[model samples]
Target: MAKFEILSLITSLLAIFVSCLALYRSRKTHSELVEFEKVHVKLSRRQIEEYEAKDAARQKTTLGAKLIDSGGIRLQVSNLGEASAKDIWIRIEDPDSYNPLVSGDYKQKIPYPSLNPGEDFTLTAFIPLSVTQQVYPIALRWLNEDGTQGDFRCTVSR
Candidate 1:
């Protein structure tokens, strides 16, 4: 009987020890999970802020081009961007072949001072009847409102 009592006491002590160990492990795991959640939330917020900033800058500048046949082939350059284009310059890749005559000026009358958003300009080009294709390649360079340089190239088709 004495031996049985001693064995029961030992078993009870072992059970208590196991319970304490399990409690300690659970608390440690919870603490680690909370720390990880904090870090993850901070990183997610920073990433969202960076993405929004880039999207805003991207929306600032956009350009659109169109070719119109109004009595003659006219190249219309429009600033469909949210901001204005400053010190805009237009250049024809091969002027001699296309024979572009803009606003009755034999020389290039490009390098307009500035073009506001939604504003546009027309350039007249006189192509010879011999050329089968009605496409003219043009290069455009300009400065943004933030003093950044922008360049674009497109083919004008009649």
Candidate 2:
């Protein structure tokens, strides 16, 4: 009876030691996983902020037009981005086959070279007096400071 009790005690001790070892390994792995998640979260946040900044910069540019008293119209392009845009060019697309009567060239790309932030460029042209509304498909392209190219397509209504 004494020998049997001693064997049982040894078995219990062995089982307890194995359980403790498994618990220690599990905790260590859990801590490592948490650390990896922290790094992933940091990287994700940085990418999101970069995209937001680019979107904000793109939204800063605007195209507008106004009718003048001399039977002509003035078209204006404004850049409200925080940084300057380089290699700026504009293209007018006639998708609907509606021809516009203008004195200046519309088929060629109008180059502005560099438009600083918060700057405006105005062009004056004689639009047809008969048309009440006109839709112009304007394509604006520019290069950012980081050598990233951006192209925007918008329609101007007058």
If scored against the real structure, what TM-score would every candidate get?
Answer: 0.66, 0.53
TM-score of model number 1: 0.66
Best by TM-score: 1
lDDT of 1 by residue, 1-158 (tens): 69999999999999999999999999999999999999999999999999998866754565666678788877788998888887777776776656454555523546767788889987776666777767667788888877788888887776
Please write out the lDDT profile of model 2 over residues 5-108, one tens digit for every residue.
99999999999999999999999999999999999999999999999988776644433333233455655667766667777776566655443435364423
How far in Å is the alpha carbon of 103 misplaced in model 2? 5.0
The root-mean-square deviation over C-alpha atoms between each candidate and the true structure, in angstroms, is: 4.5, 6.1
Q: Count the backbone clashes (under 3 Å) in each candidate.
A: 0, 0
How high is the lDDT of residue 51 in model 1? 100
* Winning model by lDDT: 1
